[model samples]
Target: MRTNQESKRRWRWARGVLGPFAISVLVGGSVSVSSGFRESELQCEEAYAHLEDCCGALHGAISCTYEEGCAGQTPALDVVQSKCIRKLSCSEIEALGMCDASAWRSDAGAPLCP
Candidate 1:
């Protein structure tokens, strides 16, 4: 009877003490996973705006898509290129061989214009 009572006490301790901790950890991990890409998305938007300014209005508007397990990382190369294009004047796009709206569409995996 004593052993059974001790077993019951241990089980209660595990449930009462460890359960909330486990739950909290799980919840925290989930939150991180869900929110991890938020920063990248914002950066993507900023890069898109830069592309619009340089490439032309809505020109080379890339939709930033991130790889799985790549959370809070820097924007992808294409997005980075969008920002870099800001150094180029919009009027110089054709002269510089830059195609208008040639950005890749993240969802369709194809050129935005084509």
Candidate 2:
């Protein structure tokens, strides 16, 4: 049996991705954050970068690789939808400016943005 003093010494508070703070516990010698963490709004460039990553993971499934019979999946698509897209508002996503996108190149050697 451990005392309150002992337990207090182990667990510590961490800043959650959301505005609210959450409790983080040291498990197996590492800290594990509680669920429901939402990070702050990403800058346009940063959000674009994240979209690029998602697209990179998804592209293989969308075209060349899949057509070549090298079948692969875009795991990051869900990540982008849930983490990046959902986190940002329509205005923020619009701010990423898909049509005028110039940040990343596409699989077809064109701009990655829509």
Candidate 3:
């Protein structure tokens, strides 16, 4: 059995030690989660921009090729594919564009027009 004074002193010590530790952990966790959400939002925006650029390029290429009646022309295909690859990477296909030209051609997927 401890004295009343000793019990009060122990309680105060425990509160002083545990209170700051708990607060620090809560604050740190909140900050980390907030940062992660911010980064994800920025990435989403970038992906959307890339997708729009790729779509515009594809539309232009298709219109040009169709008007010329050369849908199967290699030069038109190369130009369109090059523009598509430039706006996106192979791994970002699902996020940035739909075409998988990089996976289809090993040497022709580097976003360079010949």
Q: Highest TM-score, which number?
A: 1
The Cα RMSD of model 3 versus the native structure comes to 15.5
Model 3 residue 45 CA deviation (Å) reads: 9.8
Q: Each model's TM-score, in the order given?
A: 0.39, 0.25, 0.36
Per-residue lDDT of 15-64 in model 1, one digit per residue for the tens? 99999999999999999988876565666676566555555665444556
Q: Could you tell which candidate, 1 or 3, scores higher by lDDT?
A: 1
Between candidates 1 and 3, the TM-score winner = 1
Report RMSD (Å) for each prediction in the order shown.
9.2, 14.1, 15.5
Against the unseen true structure, what C-alpha lDDT does each candidate score? 0.58, 0.37, 0.48
Cα deviation at 71, candidate 3, in Å, is: 35
Candidate number with the higher lDDT (2 or 3):
3
The TM-score-based order of candidates, best leading, equals 1, 3, 2
Q: Which sequence of candidate numbers ranks them by lDDT, best first? A: 1, 3, 2
**Model 1 lDDT at residue 113:** 18
Task: Determine the backbone clash count of candidate 2.
Answer: 0
Model 1 TM-score, 2 decimals: 0.39
